[model samples]
Target: MLSACFNIISVCLSLPSLSHLLCLSFSLFLAPSLSEGVSQMFGLVVSPLFPQGYPNNVLETWDIAVPPGYAIQLHLTHLDIENSENCEYDFLKVSVDGVVLSTLCGEKSFSELRSTVNPALYSTLGSMRLTFQSDFSNTERHTGFSAHYSAVDINECDDPYTGCSHDCSNYIGGFYCSCQPGYLLQEDNTTCAVNCSGEVFSSLLGSLSSPSYPGLYPENSACSYSLQVEEGFQLVLAFEGVFDIESGERGACVDSLRIRAGGREWGPYCGNVAPKDPVVTNSNHAEVLFNTDGYGANKGWKIKYTTKAKTCPDFVTVNSVLEPKRPVHQFKDQVRVTCNKGHEIVIGAKAKHHFDSWCQKNGVWSDIEICEPVDCGPPKEIDNAELKFINESSPTTYQSQIYYECEAPYYQINTDGKAQFTCEADGMWRSSDGKLDIPHCIPVCGRPSNPLESIQRIFGGKPAQLGNVPWQVFFQSPRGGGALISDRWVLTVAHMAQVDQPYIYMGFLDARNLGQGVKLEVEKMIIHPKYKRHLGDSSQYNYDNDIALVKLKGKVKMGPNVTPICLPQSEEEGQPELGKIGFISGWGRVKPRQTGKIPVSPVLLYAKIPVAKTQSCTDVKPTGPEIQKEKFVITDNMFCAGMPGVDSCQGDSGGGYAFQGEDSVFQLKGLVSWGIECGSYGFYTKVVNYLDWIRDTMAANED
Candidate 1:
């Protein structure tokens, strides 16, 4: 209602207190142009009759609001009014959310006051109000004040006291708080908390207590705990803690506990003499409950429970469709489950849908069999090989036949039999004859183009024909030779490649011209680390771990005269080959050259020798410049291969000793490392021991 002096206004704001409700009537007055927001951006504000004589006894107010995320910024540019004691005669005031900013009277410019808290006032909650009053008697004419208000962005997110416990979002003049997906925002709209009614238990043995164990339980709470076990077991509850639940007169339960299970309900047991005996849940499932009144301070119940085998829940699978179903199967019954037609039972790696499953003495079925759709998926990918489907399949389910073939001229399936596999019902690829290894693509290697015919025919030592030993590396003179194990790698002894850049010659075999052969420049030389460490501070070097790989700067062109040798495929392949005859070829000096020219082998000479007896090899007194005075350690990593008339002599160091296996392919057995003399059963570093090292080094350094 409008009044002569003021408008009776009633405005209420919720203040944070015990009651949390507050209402205060503020005298509100809007003169012409005062109530206008001016715009959302600004609001024009001034006292009554600004810049002219003003009347008295006037108490008025103007309330301003801005958009969320922004606060109302009030700027007073001018101030001129009648002055009186304590500004009681006439005054203008600014406030926000019930907090007063300042009161002004008399004549004072916006800058006439201190820089702080005078010319401008801002609201924290995006709302601001002002009050103006005039005394009934004015001494003279005065222009009260001229001010403007606008929305200023309030960064609520930057304020730690904004009440957001998690994520906070701010917009033009306001802000809000939010929580993660699984959490619920509490009543305050700022806290994220998980709301759960009770707890769940799955263990075989445990105890449940109401809220706190020893202390008094919480007030005004209704909680439930759920327990579930395997279908055949019955849950048993035994109450054992202090029975102190609140109760009314005549021992009625004011606070109580209840149990519900298998269509049976237990008591609202209270006044707790503590249910002295145990309560049996005749079935497999159960739920325990504990409720309380608003007023209660008592230690609640504690239940120690155990499960016993009893009547079990019915069993049947939707997909498998086990037959002879029952609504309630007893633990004592020995009934068996059977699958319907078109489905066969599988037990591990076998097919026996029926008898594979059995009822155990513990009342639970062991190895419960199930029927499934026969599917083997796509056959596993075979390295270096592709497959051809032949059976009725796209081809990988039941009865799918697949044939594997190696990737062409460089590789072949290492089997005389058909390289085939079939997907059986057991979900595995099996051969027709439950034998033979899976199809693997092995390199077509170790085979020589120009054969040596027989090692015996060579007798003691002779020059190899151009392609007789295709895998031999022709390192001129006594520098050190190697075996071409791959297109770009050569295997040799570590001691021979002590120099950083060792050169390799392939294709042509000419010791006379030396550098005339095709020289393969070495890019990297990896010596056995153990062999390198054997070069410690000692008078003598043990050539025990003498093995190294040389990587050629470029791949060697394969032809009739240049090819790779095969490595030992299996772990024990070279072990049983103790007494086998092998060949070692090198361009070494049979005799020293005169006048600064060390004589290389006139041709690539190879020695036909048998692997000597270990006793005879280790029996001899060791000699040689490399062996020095140290005892020759004939470790298992070295083999003795040579007789009196046939041996890898001094200049044969680092040469590969190749053996023609039963497959008619040459596998490098060893490398000529050290010997007592030019003969004395030549000691070669066994190639088998370092097979993994060779393969790993080559694979890691591949281009």
Candidate 2:
């Protein structure tokens, strides 16, 4: 109805030439009833009905009222009155429920004006009043403003902007506040506050108690408390008094006290009996929540919280030398230590004593420590003789060396007058005799009263006893033999040295049981620079520089069965006089068949062969034409060692031809190089010719 009235009024005002009587008739029909005072459940308001211009000094008012639980919205559609910046002369003012909403004037128009009340005055009175006034003047006039007002249901819950603590409910022209079970709505009806006093606390030590503790707590009350401490300290919470809360099935608790710390949630404790022990946290922070239902509540809990410093057990000292040292103050720190040579940690003792040690949280090392050196007792004493210290420092540690001299009244030195012994890494003494027993200091060389065992003319040689020739070593894979000259070097012929997997066996004499000997792997091989093989032509092959040195992967521990032979001091020391008998030993065939093929020997055999002059070597019958041409070219680097029926055979190419020097110490004089059939003249590599080169090569490769 109000919209229809505004439409008629607009048409009437637009037609100013209309008769005054017609205008009057339309105004009487369209105007609101005077008895109702221009106020309705929903209505529209406009300026006074005048054709020319509104009468000067006029005042008009309209009141709009909507049902309860609704609000009025006014929208000004057309506005044209006077033109004044402040609307001082002719203006319209609007108020909702006696509270001024807006005042408009001049020729201005408005989109919408709502009935909003100050939050402090939260009332829902559903009425609004509009007043239009004009000063006494008849100059200019136009169609005044028209606005539509309607009562809309006030949906307080629909507008999220409405500030309500927990919940908002719309009522008749009003809204109210509501909260969850455990919270209370504040006086402002917007925010909520817990019923308890304290909410959060932070300190090293403190006490947390429910509201009105010692007495039963009020129903529908909840309290949350948070406690924090230093980063390294953990919070410990313990109940100090009787505790009780509502209990439910399956260990659930109503009106319970729950503690949360270290990312873990503890029990919702709610019984009369207190927990047996305090609850500790893995971190520095802890949060506790105390909730109560509307029913039974006991004298709530009083929990005492304190902080403890995180620490570990005391560190233990070790016996071995530590790299960074122990007693690490911080967690995750590491320490490393190593045992000295000849000293080692026992098996399974402290991670073998050479492992990385880490400091654990318990203030203890992750590894153990146990290091001990191999001990060889004091040097053995010789009877009827006094020992004179040559090294001046009596040494007994593993692999330590000691030199001594013996007084020669009744006892005589075995080799040179000066004797020495070594403490082996395996806790044994190696005497100068290359045996475990102490040197007897008996007659030099212990010359037999009668020559019982002759070195010459033995068709089949016997197996040498252990330690008889400690330097002799057998080569596997390409069966051959060599001599251990140093801990890391083996002297062999170039032919025997070229092996894919060169392995050396020492210590034991019986070649049948080579596995019982000390086995060593070869790391490097240095063959003579000029050594070469002439394919199938053995005579054309250069045997002059057949010597080669093999370096072992690791030093071989000197022992009774594994020892180094003395190297010649000079070329003269290594040169044997012509016709002087020398011993040659190997694990080769005792005798070769007439077919010239030799079988493998199981026992190490030795025989004495006279050294022959180069001219004599040429006189022997040559096996091939290549030998006849090479025999005359035999230089000083080559020598002959055998005659018919007595010789070193196949597999003895690298065996040692050693002779006891004037000093009574055996020296390597030759290396078996080649032979023209077994038991015939055999050529040997004169070791004296290449002694300098051998020494230089060893010194360069030493590690």
Candidate 3:
């Protein structure tokens, strides 16, 4: 009710002063008798698409009351299908005052009798009672219907003269005709005139029909026609479904149809039909007119035969001719080789001849090349010496640092240490026997046990002749000979007073001259819980039993070259005929120095080396009988020696291996812990393997 009369005229305009006289007396009295009774019942409307059938399910709503000037018209009829059926048409909705309205579905069948008839609205959309909908839910038959009208106007010329050939123009209800300019509009709309009249009557209508109507507008007919040919005409176009006359922009131009109709392939339509005008000077036949307003607004059905390309002519093929073939190219090569004393190159040093060649593809070789073999290590002859190899010329890149210089009269003393070589990508060179620098002091007096001479005496000092004793003075004390086992105790090597800060470097022998010694603070250092150090191999005598006893914090002043060696009570009272040559002095190292650099010496230089048998030292280089059938067991109070070209390298850590007992004096027998490379072979520990726990840990450290 117009929203309850605009809410009672907005509560009578909130009654301040009768709100503009109640909206001007409610629009001069209830809006023109309620919009003139919904514009005369929405103009006695009829088919608002109700339960129709041709395809079934329909819906159409209603609601109008619009007034001022009006304009609706929706007249949609329905037959919605039949091109032999299956042209489905279900929901086709249309609206008006509620906007929406632009519909067309499954035509055919009077093309769903379409007509908005003037549905465009903006203002005069007053008496809006428009509503049309159709949703033929899976219809077996649902027809259509929509009938509306406000400012009505239909008169579709009621088939005027069926198709006037001249002046007709009358719309708002269709009708247009202005032919007589060469005549056209003729699809049974009462004909216009000449479509093609001449050349023996277009060759007697292309020899009696079968040319399927006259081009364009004649296909599925609707209206909008056009035709004119002042110059003879014979327009014939059959092209039905997939018509692709040699498709070159979908061919079919016939500006002058003098084509004698001689092509037929009917399936996809190309059934040619040209050949009209026989002479008016060959009439040059010309009549190409088509404009069914884009073929009645196209939706399939195109037979445009416009004619023009030189009076239509197309069809060509014609093959035959030959000669040509030639192509081939391939290659390989890229070399490299390397060696030293163990010599190399017994193969094309990484050769790759001509275009990187390696041949045999599918079997593997199209490219990847490699050739490695170079780490020539131990072969530089030394026993009775006679090695001379010199093939230098490497500034780096498979480098070669040869500098042994000892051939004039033999002075080469490199005990072998640091040097390098590396050149591989297969030219092989990373290592082929050319690396020797050896330093940490290698002298091996008379050549025997030189352990980078105790890291070149501590760091680097003692050389002038072993007696020039300044290999920095020395200080390695925390145990070992706990300086005169009594006299305030000192019988060392208990894993060196098991440190965690138990410092006791007493009376300096140069730890780079520890400010001249006397820094002892150990009141303990007791070893011989049956000592252990010898980790396997040396007949496995239960490890080094190195021994230890310390106690210090006082008692000093003793000389005879810092005196302290003398503990041999048994084994037949330290025999050499019984004790005397023991001077096994330390501050370690007789040869091991890779540049781990630490050693300066402080003094204390003594030597003795001689601890034989143990199978004559595993029979000089023996660890093989296939390594004791792969597990050789040689344990039993371990004891081995070194002499096959003598060795002991690296600052022979843990010092002493002295002998001579049998009374000729000299005692302590064995301590230097490791040696395989630096000395090639040197391991020791036995002072008679912990002589009864070093005499009961020196009698319980002198009580």
Candidate 4:
């Protein structure tokens, strides 16, 4: 195979010149291209001039491939080329299948540039390319590189990176992964798993075995085999093959085989000995489990299973009685169990009535349930109220009832007004909505008012001194009146909300004594939502929900003459019955009582007035373009509290009508809203109807 590769043409015209002029840039030998490829078992690569310098400005490459199942091995015996740090000029580049293995030049050996990632001496691809290049000039002549390459077998089996579950084979340039008998390779092409889990044998006679019964069973294996036959047939299992499993001392089952059928269990046989006799399963089904630990090395067992006539076991359970009592149940028969009369299937069950058992091929009972008595725990405690059982017999089981009562003088039962909360089916004292339904204690009022006898006067009315009606409020700017309901709030009429930069004169019966008591600045005013001021004119105002609140800038210093009026809780929303007596007081018109320019009295006057029937106010509805009845409609929120010529007058809007309860303590019952004439019967906003509103409003603006 010694064919002349190429011819080198050297001209001798300048043989006498100096070494600097002896430029041999054309003295390069280029091998065949990689596309033309060379199939070689061995090859030698050398520079164009064997013992001389390599030519400048020349590039050459060689592509060599070896036979299959072999890798290319390269050995550079001599590397005396030009020297540089990175071999940037006049270098040799070695690659395999486009993957650069190494780049070499200068006087550096291959060992100095290659770690494991880039090895120049070997290639698993069985094919390689080599390129050598030179620059346009060389300062001095130097001997070039020489390398030898050959094909060698690739021993992939010894590589740590190769993957195989049991055995691995190495051949040519490739490797393969394999598994032992009874095991199949997993999708990853490496892991091996046992192929004998949950195998079913339905024939009347059959055989069961561990994976690869004749050989050693695999470690870390868990396998099961099930056998089933006709409904009337029972299974008999006998061990036949090797029965060796991993064992420990003292009859321990390190690796075990368990046999089960018809809700019965046989030996958990382990060690070298198999069971002595064939197992008689009472039903047509048999199950066997074989397991191994991580260290087992033994040939596993095999069993022969055959069927015979079946017999069923007696079925019984706790807290229940069997129906149609049977002496001996047979295969294909069924039985039912029911809870006692007072008990139910309440635990771990979806159906509460009965549990039905079927004598199937296995003769094992199915649909078993637990039964227990129904009971509810002790009832929940109330936060601010007293709770007790409604009946004398206090069994807090299902359907028991409990009631709550709020302590008076401070608290009352809140909304929903339910009398009793019941213990329901779900073992909780709950209502239809699953809420506690226990009435919470809310603020019950009217216990803190002054209990002194009435010597007061405000309208139609005689004059009284201070402390007679202590909660009285007088507005100077709009000249209206209100009552103090809290330390920082004054309940007033909505029409007086426009009093700008306003302050109230309170705790003084005499209007002339400006400094006799508290004169507080008003911080904010809230108008009632249903005030009819937006309808048309003042005369046409409905004045239905005429209530308003004036928040004081700071908390009041409560004293003998300065205390809050407690809110009143009444039956039927505090509806004052006909002829109910209450005192009306304010700094309202008390002079001649004529319409125009009537002067408010220099003193606060109060008058005792009785609640008039609803029809009395309806009979006197104003009959003008200001059709009062049409606009007002005398809703349930308003009541007529004063009779003709003895009622609240002009400048009297927002005055308090105070009613004394059975305990002689006074509570604000209504506010003077509107009337048709001076000192005549007038309509008042019912303070009782707004209890929820007032409580919510006061809570919403709490400091």
Candidate 5:
């Protein structure tokens, strides 16, 4: 037994040497060129444009073995690629024994490909096999590759297609077999067969073989199949339409479709059937469909679309037939609860317009919504200048107020005839007589338009009186002013001329011949009672009483040549808003829109800026919390107007806001107050709101 064991050990010790001798002898004939220093060639066996790996191309496999503690070095070539057109290539791969090592993209110098190998790695590898596989497919020209070996042992497996589910048979240098389950091996096992279920399937997979797809469908190419399943199985299918070369329409007007399953058959449905709006799209491709219960018990059934009897095209294609499904309604029958009898429920709360939800007891309606009764403030008695409150019960909400005042000679008023009262709980206030009085009205100078016939000839024939017509005059200030009540009192915004320097030329028609015309220095210039020269908070759209009356030094002349325009009845009240047209004239700058250089025009030019709706002014402003809190308050007393692209400029301030009124008349509506930016929508004060106050002030001054 000992002797036999020794013999076996001796044979085992020599086995490795014997194997190396055999490998060397075999390589002698096959790799003679490599032994003579000819380098090996490595690269993509075929181009990568093919959708699948190379067609009808076989992989070349070579075996190699490196005993532990030893590494093999080999030179490789042909990896260098010059500028070649259509140069899309698969990766070049290297392997050790039967295991893959690495894959690289594009081409590299022969030195680089050879240097990619690590001596320590190759030394540890026991066996390897190099395969030149066509990783891409094409019907174009073929490219073959070869390898050179100086000294190496080839390690090939018994069954190259090992682990394959189907029959794996070993051949000379490689193995072959078909894939198992859900697939059938093609003539070349490299390609696998696909399995389709649930509906009629074709061998070509994605592509269909129906005839005349879009315009017409041939009966012979039409197909139908069935499936068997449990009581409630889902039926899913997807298809796409094919179009004709000429017409863009779909196959033979699909008049109707029907599906038969379980024991009953669904009716022949119209081609217009669709889950979401049945109209088809351009690409006409369908992806997935999953539906259950709608088709009853899942079983062998036919789904098809048919045309009207005796149509040009006979049968409809499967592409026209879509999978039908039932829709779900999330809300069934929901109810909402209302508040107690004394309280009312807002429309959005009790009867919601969207998302349909009901109200419960603890659910508060304040946040959601709540309806309230309409309440108008109590009536006030306008006695002279005092406003007396009769009823006071309702509460005030927004910027609600009952303005108060008294008529002429009453510097202060007594509310309720006893004391000047304040706003009451019911939103009412008691005033002296609801009006203020003026001291003495100063006469405003009118331009000489018609002058006397002899005076007109000397002043170049021009009309003097033309219903508050603006006249050319010389004033120290850049801006101009207007007449408020009569030819004596002139209404000019306070900012135009400073308090220290004030002068007026009463009869100056044109600035060119200024010294030749009648001139007068301002004697007593009375600014508006509440006129703050600075823009002030009024720039915030709040003009807290901006009316002034100027008293001239003396009343020089009067007639058709010079007469003050009559003031409208209610000077401070808002007028009935009927589309009003008026003109604005000024001497600040003829073309203020032009650059720094201004036109030296003493003559006022005017443009008709139509009054715009208040809503339009608010729409153009920027929206945000800052703008809202800073300047976006729309008060009841304020009136806004302007055309979007056009507006008054610097020279137009303190000018008249004229509009046609009752009895075929042109009257001054309001006065220009203050504006931030020039040539932007301008806002004006409503003259009608303060008519009583204006008349009272004028009368008080006159006294």
Candidate 6:
């Protein structure tokens, strides 16, 4: 049983084998009445030497000491001593810092006993002392007593009895109370209270009111609120709840709410009425002051303020009508202004005519303008030319065209050889192409006129005079060709109108100088209903009704180089006699199907080919089943023109075929539709067949 007790004690103490030898040595020789103290660094085990009771009058005391921050824990594992009433004899007593905590006797055992040091007594260290006394009798003893003592660090912060109002900070032996910012610890050293005088706020949005707002404020109190926002913004303050303060007979406020901003004072508000509108500052900073007299106070005022982007006063004005006619405008907004017809904008000495104004970031408008009436002044005189106004007198105004004629020898008047000048939208006399140069009369021809001059000899045909065939219109890119039939309408092949918004170049002589030509945007396209790619089968192709009308977004101002071709008065008047020579013009390839080749001629080129009999075109044999289809036969609405080497090629599909009329003017006879190959006999859509349709369609879509 003694060996068992030694083993149990050694395991409970977690001693090493060598330490276990020392522990056994100490347990066997430990004096019951020795005066030496037991320092419990790890723990101490207590037991009498024998299983029987100790000698008579036995008195033993143990002074257990731990570190300054630690407290002792005692566990009475076994106790068999002499039993006595009220622990008068053979009693064990435990005390901490000289204060008795527990007294044991009567063979009773205890599970645990901890140090009873007050955590609030932080200046003193924790310590305990144990006393064991026995009466002068050697009879009753059963192992006497056995106990284990351990030291533990005391945690004052975890004590539920602590009364720290704000925060509790613990040290080795004890703990203390601390207060947060804007709060002061009370006399009890644990409770805290807010320091209202130190209150301050800084942010884009916040609230400020009289002290104890929404309730009666104390007498003789004053508070100030200061707010700031971003550099380019201003503060807006709004008031809510009841507002009452001391007032005088003259309506002057004694105890009041005062607002100051941008070096200016806004209010000394008092009485029951609040401000009708929110107070806005002119700058980013604002100050609110609340003052109360030593008298009665009503429900205090509650006010909220937020920052808003700064704005500039209205400084922009327009001569024309404006979309938003407000007196003030915010930054980065656009103001649109438009002028009335026949009127333009005049900013300074120069005329602007049309545009919009922008409110810049720096709070300034891009342009300030007003609309004024248009006046073109008297027409410039040309040498050997006479000005002729539609009205007898000169009624010069916007969009008015003045007619002029060159005297006899000098037949050509304007720069483009057209005897007219138009007063444009900008109140200036200009040509159709926007040229500022004044027109002058010039001699019509430098060579003598001849009756039998062969027209098809010059470079293929002849380099046409700049204004000779003004109706010719050339497609700019994705190249093709067309002829103007009206002021804003061009007639071309349906295939030539494939581009979504094709640009047409007109009113220029040399095709290389295409920039000098006026480019018009195609707004609408109408292809003939009968137009088809494959008529009878996929192999057989047809271009029979390959006609389309292109409507331009704006009207073409007519000049010598840009004029509409004259349409025939009737279908009968359009059809020329068969076998008569007719001219076809285009900016197409010179040779038939010239692969990978650009047109050699940059100028408008023409070819004169005799109209072929229908039987002659029909007699041509089909090379394959593709061309042997019945629908591929020559019909009356189509006419064959050109022979072998001299024909309209690939790029000439949308050009015009015309012959001289009795009036000596060229009238449109046909439209280049398609051909068997490039140079072989080409078929043209006979314009005489669709004259009524053309006129009716144009009239219906007129702008």
Best candidate according to TM-score: 1
lDDT of each: 0.72, 0.69, 0.37, 0.72, 0.39, 0.68
lDDT of 5 by residue, 320-368 (tens): 2111211311112123323222223336434321222322221211133
Q: What is the lDDT of residue 416 in candidate 6?
A: 61
- TM per candidate comes to 0.37, 0.36, 0.20, 0.36, 0.30, 0.36
Query: After superposing candidate 2, which stretches have Cα over 4 Å from the reference?
Result: 1-460, 533-540, 593-597, 622-633
Best by lDDT: 4
Residues 104-132, model 3: lDDT tens digits: 44543334354232334222444444333
Higher-scoring candidate on TM-score, 2 or 5: 2
What lDDT tens digits, residue by residue, belong to model 6 across residues 1-703?
A: 0112222233234446545433332343333334455554444445446455566677777776666667666666666666777788777777767777767765553432223222221212446666878777756445676665656667777877677766898876567788766556767776654333435556778888876667776554556777766666678889877776667778888788888888888888988889989998766787787776646757778888887656655545433565587765765667777777667766567765567887654445677676666779888886657887764443687777777787654245646665666887667877767776887664332111221235554224555666666677888665678878766788888778767888779867577888988898888988877776443425435666777899998766655566666667786788857777877777777664433655545778777888887655655554444555356746677888777667786667788887766556567788887676555577888888878778888889976
For model 3 the local lDDT of residue 79 reads: 34
In candidate 5, stretches whose alpha carbon ends up further than 4 angstroms from where it belongs are 1-474, 506-509, 515-521, 533-543, 559-561, 571-578, 592-595, 598-600, 618-638, 644-646, 662-664
Count steric clashes of candidate 6: 3
Put down candidate 2 lDDT per residue, 14-51, tens digits, no spaces. Answer: 45675553423234335454235533455656677743
Q: Indicate the TM-score of model 3.
A: 0.20
Q: Poorest 10 consecutive residues of model 4 by lDDT?
A: 1-10
Order of candidate numbers by lDDT, starting with the best? 4, 1, 2, 6, 5, 3
Q: Tell me each candidate's RMSD, in Å, in order.
A: 29.1, 21.7, 30.2, 22.7, 33.9, 25.6
Candidate 1's C-alpha runs over 4 A off are 1-443, 455-458, 476-478, 514-517, 533-540, 591-599, 619-630
Candidate 5, backbone clash total: 61
- What digit string (tens of lDDT, one per residue) describes model 1 on residues 334-403? 5555554434666667665454333443446555666654666677676667878897535776667888
Model 4, span 307-362: residue lDDT tens = 76555566546657777777767666667888664456765544385788866555
Give RMSD (Å) of candidate 5 vs. truth: 33.9
